[model samples]
Target: MIKKLLPFIGEYKLETILAPVMITIEVALELMIPFMMARIVDYGILGDGGMTYTIQMGSLMVLMAIIALIFGALSGRYAAIAGMGFAKNIREGLFKKIQTYSFANVDKFTTASLVTRLTTDVTNTQNSFMMVIRMAVRAPVMLIGATIMAVSINPQLSTVFIFSIPVLGTALYLIGKFAHPRFLDMLEKYDSLNEKVQDFIVNIRVVKAFVREDHEEEKFVDNAKRVKDAQLNAEKLVVLNMPIMQMTIYTSVVAILWFGGNMVIEGTFNIGELSSFIMYIMQVLISLMMLSMVFIMLIISRASFSRIVEGLEEKPVLDDGDADPQLKPENGDIEFKDVSFSYSDDAEHAVLNHVNLSIKSGETVGIIGGTGSSKSTLVQLIPRLYDVQSGEVHVAGRNVTQYKLNTLRDHVAMVLQNNVLFTGTIKENLKWGNEEATDEEVIEAAKAAQAHDFITAFPDGYDTELGQGGVNVSGGQKQRLTIARALLKQPKIVILDDSTSAVDTATDAAIREVFREHLNDVTTLIIAQRITSVSDADKIIVLEDGKINGFDTHDNLLKSNTIYQEIYESQSKGGGINE
Candidate 1:
């Protein structure tokens, strides 16, 4: 864990070094204050008792206190700035790394886990860094300085100091060993509780629709209880150290006073020296106690850091297409040659079997299948969302894997089944399709997708702020907006995966008509469950169990394709498409 954090601090090496240096200076000043107190008592008060010497020593003590306070304040300010900057750099780096991860890599770490790492885990590490620089350095310096001062004042009184050091060290080591595993468990419970709460909030509508509020509440309660219990156990182990250290400190102080009194009575040490020795011993022991607490915090932070490093170290399953050269295709043609894929290597079933297909430029094709028939999966492969397990996916007569991911995705625009709308104005969402697009271009795309009329009807028109996921808009409006966003891309190929399902049949027909007229030269692939939705396509492919069951024109398929015929007849008789 220390090794992982070293790189984040590397860029701030100057500040990191400077912060500890300032802390050391502050600790030295603090040590001098004690010595100054000893001087005032021994020489200024008990000596010939000259007014000049007393006044001089008293003035020196005031100067030392003021200097200590200034250095302490400087150290604190520098430590805070350095620690916060380190945390910001780390969080930004992690967020960028997450953006580069492939879909497969993202699936390995769930959204809830990522959120916890970005927030709670990073906060723990940041707190530890701040405490280490701000207080951890000073505690050790004070402890060692006080020990030296005590031994110098009277060697016989230093015996208690030596004994108390070992007792504190043992307590810190034992508490750290016990608390490390508990801290890891406690963080895991925290992530589980976060996941449960996120799920409940995101699916609140579903829960209300099904009247399962009590069920969800019970589930959340159970997860929260687990987190509470784990935290309590961790706190119990950590809090035990303080009382044990206090016991050692009190015992050592009692022994120091008892033994020092005997030495003073025997004339081996004077009253003033014994008093200074006891004061130094107390200072040393208290510093050790504070240091022990800092050590435990570092232990817990290390545990959290390990989890964060694990996420950063993960490699994306899909390569960035860096090693491969650019693929210059002959034309906008796509071919899937014996393609097979699965979500995982150990999965019992593949989502797509040995499927083969070819689509020429300027062609319109439709893919019809039941739920889980891999229609969406086939289109996802075109943009390389998932790598083919056993075959090649080619674009423009060249393998897609040979092109950079961004270059390939640039030519292929996809409107997914699950349409997502970010929090922004309608114009802003449309601009995501093409940032340089003019207002005229946006209006044209919106008109083609049959979204212009409704958008203009809104009070603010294109400037209206869309709520999260377009919650303020109807489902049909959201679908049309997504379609408009994709249309504005004007790519070589457009894939609409059941994009028109939310709109009424009349609106769907109008959008299809616009697509036919404006996108005549664009290669289009439509995946739909409604036979009426794809009946006008030049070709239709019916899929069953990951294999092509039939491939023909829609009219020809009505007679030759059993699956297509069944779907058509069912929908014609008021039986909705199964998917």
Candidate 2:
């Protein structure tokens, strides 16, 4: 997991290397200051050396301190650069990986979970990375350096560390062992909290209309409290870290003071050497304290790092590695042979059964069914959005799996059941279909989708900016705008997945007419709730329980197919027969 994440350091390699080097230099120089102070006291003040030597040693100590400060600052600066750059690259990689995921892959991990991994989890990992580069090095070096100096001064006095150091180490190990699971539980609660908020926000309008704001607030509060409890549970164990250090720290100091005081009185150890030894003991204890803090950070971030790595290492549901790079879709022709698909592993609940169909280029077909007829599922196979569980789906005579995903999807445009528009001008959203589309091409596609007149009515015309999700437009207008965007692709195949249900019959009829005249060469499949929408098609398919119950001209289906008759009767009773 660590190896996979490290490669994202990319351009920050220099800073990653420099940060620890700078910190090592800083730690070394800082260690020398205490030794130099001991020289000033023992040699110059008490021994034969005069005040000049004291002043000289004092000046040298100050110079060392200044150099250490500069190096410390450089280490911090480098750590920040490396840490932030590593996180940025990780985010970019995660996002690009998500783009390649098949629909099945997306379903495996929910939206809220992915968002948490990208934001909060990444932040935690970044802080740990920077600390590891800086403090992780500093703590160990400081501890070893101080211990060596203290042992050199009085080997017997330094034994006090043996008892205190082991005690502190044991406490840290126990705390880390217990706190890891607590932190892991906390991050999962964060996912639940985020899901609660995201679900409420996406459906805010429905909540408002249903007068369920209080219900939502109560649910949110409950989830928020769970998150708080999980966090407190983890922190309570980590909070033990400092108190344990303090107890060990003060106990060692008291022992050193007592034994060394007796030694000083006997002239076995000089006052200056004792003073420097006490400083070294303090440094060693303080370094132990730093280690405890780093331990706590690593325990917490370990959970987050696991999550990020899990997401990063997830193989996309679809792989195009063996696909022919030059395999381009040349026509709108499509065929499905004995294809079977199930969202779950059980074959009894397959969303699409062994279905077979052939659609020729330029054929405009209508597909009619009840809610669970797998109308959308069938067309999704054509573009290779979801691969079949068994058998094959062919586009332009070649198996969809043979071509690169981009090559297959570029020629097949789909307007899904739930249309989405980003926060941008109408023209910008349309250009998503074709980035290089000319103004004339843009106007033509919009005109064909019956969006030009209403768009031109606005003051900004095509350049009018839309609010998020195109909230400024009505549902019907939003539908037409999505149609216009899809038409801009000029794709060889277009799938309208109940995309016109929001628009009125008149506008829907106009859009269909435009398809006939301008998109005549493209194979079009329309999924509709109303029979009139498909009543005039070149042919209509009636799907029942993932099987094709009937496929024929609209008139023949109405005459012979029971499922088609039932659908037509259900819709025509409203007096819009063949509208």
Candidate 3:
């Protein structure tokens, strides 16, 4: 994990290096102070030549104190720079890597989980890095340095450090070892808490409409309580560290006072030497306390670090680097030959199986299927959103995987069933299809998608600020806006995956008419549940149980295909068929 995180230190390498160096110097200067004060006491205060030596030693001590303060300040500044910079790099790298994930890759993790890893996990790791650079360097140096000084001053009293150090070390090690697993549990509970919050907020309207606020609140409280319980469990172990540290500190201090006071009385140690030894004992114990805190931080951050590394090192399922960049989807010709696919690798059956079909450029194809018939799954494969387990999907005379992913997707525009829209002006959202599109071009695409009239009805017109996910608009309006965005791309192939479901039949027909007139050269694929939506298509595909039950012109299928005949008869009797 340390190796994985080191590279994120990138441009801050100098700050990371300098922080520890400055801290080490500060510790060294701090160790010198107690020894200097000892000399000031024995030779300057208690000796025959009193005033002159006292003044000189006091001046030296003041100089050392000032230098130590400066080192301490520099170390803090450098640690902050290194910690913040490292975190920024990791966040950027995580986001960029997520952008490269295929649909299958994205399906492995949830949005809430990823958000937590990027924010909470990265923050924990950053804090741990800062503490490691500063206290980690200072504490060990102080411990060893103060130990040597105390031994040199009076080895007999220094025996307290030897006993206290080992005891504190054993206690801290046990606390950290026991607390680590609990901390890991606490972090996982945090991920669940974030997930619940996100889900509740995103679906708040549904909760209100269904009068399920009480249920959601109960769920939220339960999740919150779980987080609290897990935290307390982890903290219960950590709380042991401070008490153990305080006990060691007090024990060492008392032991030094007793033995050293006796030595001073016996003339084996001077009063100045005994005083310095007591100060050294305090420094040693305090350094041990600092080291214990560092260990505790490492225990908490270990889980967060592992989560971050999983996101960073996740290999993308699809990569276009091996594809020929020169190859591109020139036209909208599509073919599926013996293609079989499943959402899971070891599923009992494919969601789409043995599918063989073909469509030429400029043709309008309509697909009708039951809820789980995999119509959207079929269209997603055209852009290589997910790869086939066997056989192949071909577009524009080459395998879909042969063309660079960007090249293939650039030519294919899909307005998904969800009809997602960002929180931006109407024109701004449309520009996602073509970032360089002018105002006129955006208007033209909206007009083509039958969205211009409703957009202009708003007071702000094209510049209206949309709520998140276009919440302010009606469902039909959101669908139209998404269609407009996809049309703005002007791709050779356009797939509407039940995108017009919310619009009335008249409006749906108008949108289809506009497609026929303006997109004469673009291949269009429409998936609809209503018979009227596809009755006039150049070809209508009827999918049943992952197989093509019918594939032909609507009129031809009405006479021959059993599934098509039954659907046409039902819709016609219901007065819903268009033609």
Candidate 4:
């Protein structure tokens, strides 16, 4: 895990080096302070009248204590800042990588899983990095220094140090190995819990409409309890390590005192030396405790690093088409010859099959079909949202696959069936279509989409914040705003996928009239379910089960096609269709 996270540190190598160096100095200073305390106790208070030596040693100890505190604080401050900055860079890099991924790659990892990776997992790795720098290096230095000092004081009693250190190391290793798998399980449970909560919030309206609040609560509780159980199991293993280590060190201390007491009575060991030995043993035990914490953090960080690598290594399925640089179409002529497409290899059937169509430049084409007739799927192919399995889709007189994606999409604009609005001002949303559009151009597009009147009535007008997903706006207003956004692009081709479904029939008619008058030079494709919606188009195509059944002008289709006549009759009987 340390190797994996090393690259994110980048130019902060100096900070990383300084943190450990400062910590080592602090540990050495701490060891000296304990020995000075023994000096103050044995020599200053009980020695032959020697005020000069006692005062000098005591003042030196105070100065060393102050220096230790300064180094410790500097080490902690630098480690924390470096860890936080490194984590921020990792998260930003991951987000940019995700943005470049195609739809197929994104589907491999769900939104909630990505969110967990970006936030909770990154935080875990960052905290571990901080702890390693702040304590991992200093602990070993303090332990080794204390051990050498104790052995030098009295080699006869050093046998207890060798016995206790090995026991502490073994106990920590065993507990860490057992707890590693449990921490990984806990991370998985957290992902599942996040997914459930996200789904509930997104579909809260449905849950309320069906009165399933209690059912959702039960589901959430079950997921939360699973996370709690995994966490508890891992914690039980980790908490046992501290006490076991303490017990081993305590036993060693008892043995040391027993041997050292005999030596004291036999006039072999000094009182000051024995006192310093006991203090060194305590320092070694605390150092072991810090080492144990480092190991536990390493286990948690390993799990988080795996998730980050998984996201970084994912491959986008869509390949960039090798496009011609000098290919520019003079008109918005479109053709699909024997087109067929399936979302994946395992899909049982194609969403579009052997479809054939042709539309002249600047023609208003209407696509009418029943539910699941693949109307939206057909239009999506023109923009290369999903490439066809066989056959060709030509746009502006060139194969779509042979044109650069940016160039091909630049000439086309689509308002999807599911209207989406970002959190921004009205003017900001419209400018998404054309970033450089002037205020005059924005208002013109809004009026063409029949959105100007309602927008002007708002207190802040175009500057009002829309809130998340435009929840502050009504459905009809949102659809019209989206249409205005698409209109501002001023593309050669426009596809409205049932965009006016929320407006009244009169408003829909007015919008269509505006399209005819102002956008006559641009080719328009309208996908709708209502017969009245497509009755005035220059051409209409009726689709059934992924195949075109009929294609003609509305007047000719009404006379020649029974399906068109039936749709018109049904809408007329229902006192006209809603927009």
Q: Give the candidate number with the greatest TM-score.
A: 2
lDDT of each: 0.85, 0.91, 0.91, 0.86
lDDT of 3 by residue, 412-454 (tens): 9999998899999999999999999989999999998889999
- Cα misplacement distance, residue 356 of candidate 1 (Å): 0.7
Q: C-alpha displacement of 439 in model 3, angstroms? A: 1.9
Q: Which is the better candidate, 1 or 3, if ranked by TM-score?
A: 3
lDDT of 2 at 206: 92
List pairs with backbone clashes in candidate 2: none
Q: What TM-score would you give candidate 1 relative to the actual structure?
A: 0.95
What is the TM-score ranking, best to worst?
2, 3, 1, 4
Look at candidate 4 and tell me the lDDT of residue 398: 79
* TM-score, every prediction: 0.95, 0.97, 0.96, 0.90
Expressed as tens digits, the lDDT of each residue in 1-579 for candidate 4 is 457557888766778888998999999998997788777667776676277778888889889989989999999888988888789878987898787676667677888889999999999988988888888898899889998888888787987778877787788788878888888899899989999999998778789999999999999999999999999988898888878877887887898899988888998987777888899988887888888888878876777888888887676555554678666556789999998877776435877778899998889999998899999989998877777888999987778888766677777889999889998899999899999999999999999999999999999998989987888888889999999999998888899999988888888999999999999989999998777778889999998888888999999998998878888888878877543
What is the total number of backbone clashes in candidate 2? 0
Runs of candidate 3 exceeding 4 Å displacement: 573-575
**Candidate 1 residue lDDT tens string, 501-569:** 999888888988888888887889989989878888989989998889988898899888889988888
Clash count (model 1, backbone only): 0
Total backbone collisions for each predicted model: 0, 0, 0, 0
Q: Model 2: per-residue lDDT, tens digit, 1-579?
A: 667799999999999999999999999998888888888788898787789999888888888889999999999999999999999998998888888888888888888888998999899989999999999999999999999999999999999977887788789899999999999999999999999999999889899999999999999999999999999999999999988899888999999999999999998998988999999999999988888888889999999889989887889878889999998888999898999999887888998889989989999999999999999999998888888889899999999999999988889999999889999999999999999999999999899989999999999999999998898888888888888889888899999999999888898999999899888999999999888788778999899889999989988997899989887787778686755
Clashing pairs in 4: none
List the candidate 4 regions with Cα displacement exceeding 4 Å.
38-49, 164-169, 321-331, 390-392, 397-408, 555-573, 576-579
